[model samples]
Target: MDVVNLNQFCIIFPCYVMMILTILWIWRIVNWVWIRPLQVEKSLRAQGFNGNPYRLLHGDSRDMAAMIRDAQSRPIHLSQRNILPRVLPLHHHIIANYGKASFIWIGPEARVLIMDPLLIQEILNKNNVFKKPTPNPLAKYLVCGLSGYEDLKWAKHRKIINPAFYLEKLKNMVGDMSTSCSAMAKKWEDLFEGRMVIEIDVQPYLWELSCEIISKTAFGSRNEEGKKILKLQGEQAELTRQVLQSVYVPGWRYVPTRRNRRLKEINSQVCTLLRSIINQRQKAIELGHVKGDDLLGILLKSNEKEIEEDESNCGMSIDEVIEECKTFYFSGQESTSNLLSWTMFLLSVNKEWQDRAREEVFRVFGNDPLHFDGLNRLKTLTMIIYEVLRLYPPGVIFNRIIYEDTKLGHMTLPAGVHLLLPIILLHYDRELWGDDAHDFKPERFSQGIAKATNNQLAYFPFSWGPRTCIGNNFSLLEVKVTLATILRRFSFQLSASYTHAPAYVVTLQPQFGVQLMLTRL
Candidate 1:
């Protein structure tokens, strides 16, 4: 009788534990989906922010998607200059209806859009308080190196990566950049094939050129292997973009969805390739067969020095190195390619600027082999690049998350709230930039960036403040070289088939490829 009673007691205890665990899980879901959002919405409303009311777990996601689809369906005419409506449809609609100081729901989180330059300056400056939001788990699989890290980790990585983008190092890479650009020019020449002028879409070629330049600069001798890695990263960027568009469901990444599976496969393939490249590099270094001059070489050297000095064993592991390499591939390729494509398109439409830039390139280089020193003399070309960046900045919006209740300007932002800085909107603000804000006038930057906006924090193509992009100089140098090389060989104009639709996919890009008529000089 005693044995039977004990067995029943044990069975009852197990059942009770399961019941309690299930209840706690249900409560957590309820709080996350309903209760917490309501609390945040109330707090925001009391703070004088207005936006679409929160609606269950979806929030404003459904509305945002519908607006984007509608905007994408209609392409603006080439003559139209303001792409704010099309590029950021949802944000445009919210700001128009709810005013500039508005909050929008990103799933359960409330994202407050801050367009005031002063506030943007504050947010960007206080890196400790306003932190980079945690990336979506699915998106993280693609690339998350220095850009994704925070605090000491970010500082450590940035320190290690800084040497690679030093002015001298970037100057060294100009030759590689010019080589890739010249190869692209050769391709265009071949396509002309005795024709004085040939119609071609320069977008894909620009992409390839950017990839090749990054491959050669980042990996040196193993550029062929680097090219394959970059190609895989390109695919990964597209896949990651898709994942970012929707509201991320918790634990949904573990589900064996088609997109998830493909992302995993790509991640695995990229890692394997990177490992092979890194291992080969290590072996070459051991054998003293290679000079550590490329980006990877510089990084490895820096990491070794850091470990030797620190004694904390804080040097980056192989996996961290791989992640940084992925970042170098993605950011290095994306920023320059988009800048060149947009610059070409803008030049194609504005023929006078195109002619002026060509003239500057000729005066500076003068049929000489393009060199690093000549890049600075192309003042007209520099102005043009800056204007293109202002008009169609590669990164449309920058986001930061508040982990603790923080004071931002006059408002006290609550924890768990996200802050958004809409760069496109600021770039087109008539109040700040005057009546010709929407115009493609490159001369605005004639006296330089400080004089352009009266030394305000209004213009930040590569971001601003302490945490500005480390690769800004690297990207600008590459763009200058590529554009100078192309301008020396060919004069271009927009083709009749060209469409003026700028789409945001990780970076701002031509939705329909940039078609142009290139004439050999």
Candidate 2:
């Protein structure tokens, strides 16, 4: 009788525990999807601001996704460069309905759109107050490096990495940039041999060109194995695109799903490859065989010098250094490729500006070797680059988080609220940019950025304040070399097969790919 009773007690206990666990899970979902977001929305609405009411579970994700789907379904004419409709459907819709200063729900967080230039500048300037929000765990696997780091760690990384992007250092990379761009161009020229004009989608080649430039500059090697490292890095970037589309749920990365497993595998592979390179370089340095002069070389050298001064003050670990290499590779490759693609598209449609740029390139480097000073002399090229950035910024949405309660503009934002400064909205504002905001006019930047937005904090394609893009100068120099080299050899126009669709992947890019008709000059 005693044994039978004991068995019954055990069975009943197990059943009760299962019931209780199920109840708890239901409660969690309710609180997370409904209760918490409703509370935040109430707090925001009480602050005298306006926006769409919070929706269950997905916030505005469903609506935003649907809107994007509908927008991208059609193709706009190439001459219509205003991509605000497709790239930023939700933001554009909200701004139109709820006014400029408004709010929206991205998951449980309230993303307030702060549009005032002064207010935006203040937020960007006060990094301590408006800290970068915690990134998704899976995102860390993609590319976090210096951008995601905060405060002290960020400072250390920036200090060590600064010399790599110094104007003098970047100038040393001009030959590499020219060579990489020309390699792709030569391929295109060969394809067009004995032909007057040939149509080709330019994105694929430009993507290769950007990757090759980084590989040449980053590793300073023409060897076979370094090419594999670059090839893997490029593949990793491609894989991350679909993963980026998902809203990050905590611990979802631990599920060992196919995508998650693949991402982890790729990340591990990249780190391993980078470590091999690092070890080889360290061995060479110890033997006094070479001075590290490439970006990776400079960073390692800088770190070594710091550690030598004080043993306690060590440099980055092998893991950290690998992350940095991935950072440079991803940022340099992604952003510059987009910049070049858009610049060429604009130049293709706006032949007047194309002529102006070609004329300037000829005047500055006409039959002479392209030099560092000559890049500075291409003022017309500078204007075009600035204009392209304004119209088509690679980073469309910049965000900040308030870790504690903070006062912004006319209201006090509660702790944990996220602030969004949409660059596309600001760039296309009529009040800031005058009546021709949507038009393709590089002249706005002719007298320079200060005169462009009437000296307001209105332009920040690379970003603003202390945390602006570290690779901006490096990227610009590459653009100068690639553009100057390509313009010297060929003239291009938009191919009839081309569809004008600017998309927001990890960065803004041509959705259907950029097709151009090339005429070998």
Candidate 3:
């Protein structure tokens, strides 16, 4: 009887332990899916915020996705300047129904859309209190360098990478940028094939031009390898886009799905290539076989200097350096290509602006090679670029998450609430930009950004304050060079086949590509 009782106790005790664990897990899930979200909703509603009531674990995700699909189904006219509705359908709808000061649900998370420039200024300035939200785990596989870092780590990477993008350092890269642009121009001319005018899709050419420029400037002599890395990154960007479009399940990235497997494979290949390049560059630098002049060289040199100063707590590891290189490729390529594409499209449609820009380009350079000083002197071109950025900014929205209860303006936001600073909405806000906000008026920026924004933090194409994009100046310079070079050779108009559809995939891009009829000057 004693032996039988002991055996029964062992089996029964194990069952009891399993039951307790299962109950705890279920309770945690219930709290996350129901209780916590309701509590957050209540807090937000009490604070005068209006949005759709929370519904289970999905929140407003289904509606948001539906709205986006509906919006993308129809193409807006080329003459339509109010692209806010098309680019961000759900946000536009929410703001229209719930007013500007409102909240929306992204999964169980409550993301409040703050369009007030003053509050945005505070959010951008107070980086410590309102921090960058954790990015989608899968995005890290594509590119996560300085942009993905937070607090002290961000500072360290920014400090080490600063010298690489300094005005002086970028000046050294101008020649490479000019050469790449000239190459693209030659390719276009060859495609003309003795024809006076040719209708070509400039989007692909612009992408290629941007990619080549980044490869050469970022990697110097190892540019061929850089090109290979960028090609892989482009694939990774597309895959990541697909993943982001779908509902993201926690731990889904680890599941060995076909897409997941491909992403990992591409990531592995990119890392292998970058690691090889970095190792080779380091070896060459140590042997004094190469002068560290390009962006990578400057970054490596800066990292070494940082380590020498504070050996224990400074400098980036090899993996971190590789990430930054990936960032250089992605940001440099994506931003410039999009800016140029839109500039071409806008210039094509608005012939007066195109002529004015071309006139300015001719006056500055006069059929001569582009120089840094001359590019800066192209004031009209600068105004046009600024306007394009205002209309079709690369990043439409900026996100921040608070880790603790924080006071923003008059309201105290609870911890875990996310903040969204919609750059596009503020840009198109009639209150800040007046009634003609949506119109493509390059003249608005002629008096400079401060004068245009009335000294408020209204216009931030590359964002504003302490955490502004590090590549702002670099991107502008590349755009100027490429645009000036192209403007010098050809006068372009939107081709009849061109469709005016701007889609937001990773960044704002011409959904059907920017096709133009190029007439040789």
The TM-scores, one per candidate, come to: 0.97, 0.92, 0.96
Q: Write the candidate numbers in order of decreasing TM-score.
A: 1, 3, 2
Candidate no. 1 TM-score? 0.97
lDDT of 1 by residue, 275-339 (tens): 99888888888789999799999999999999999898679999999999998888988888988
* Residue pairs that clash (backbone atoms under 3 angstroms), model 2: none
Please write out the lDDT profile of model 2 over residues 1-521, one tens digit for every residue.
59999999899999999999999998988877788778878888898667888877667766777777788787677556567888888899988898987898776678999889999999989887888887777767768888988998888888888988888898889888877777888899999869899999888788778878887788766335455655665666666655544566777989988878877887888788778887888788789887778888898998887788768877788888988988877788889988999999989999999988999999988978788988999999999999999998988989899977799877888888889999988999998998889988999888999999887999999989989999999899999998998898889998878888888767888888889999988
Selected candidate, larger lDDT, 2 vs 3: 3
User: lDDT per model, in order?
Assistant: 0.89, 0.84, 0.89
Clashing residue pairs in candidate 3 (N, C-alpha, C atoms within 3 angstroms)? none
How many residue pairs clash in each candidate at the backbone level?
A: 0, 0, 0
Error of 1 at 400 (Å): 0.3
Model 3 gets an lDDT of: 0.89
lDDT value for candidate 2? 0.84
Q: Per-residue CA lDDT of candidate 3, range 134-155, in tens?
A: 8788877988899888999999
RMSD values, in order shown: 1.6, 3.3, 1.8
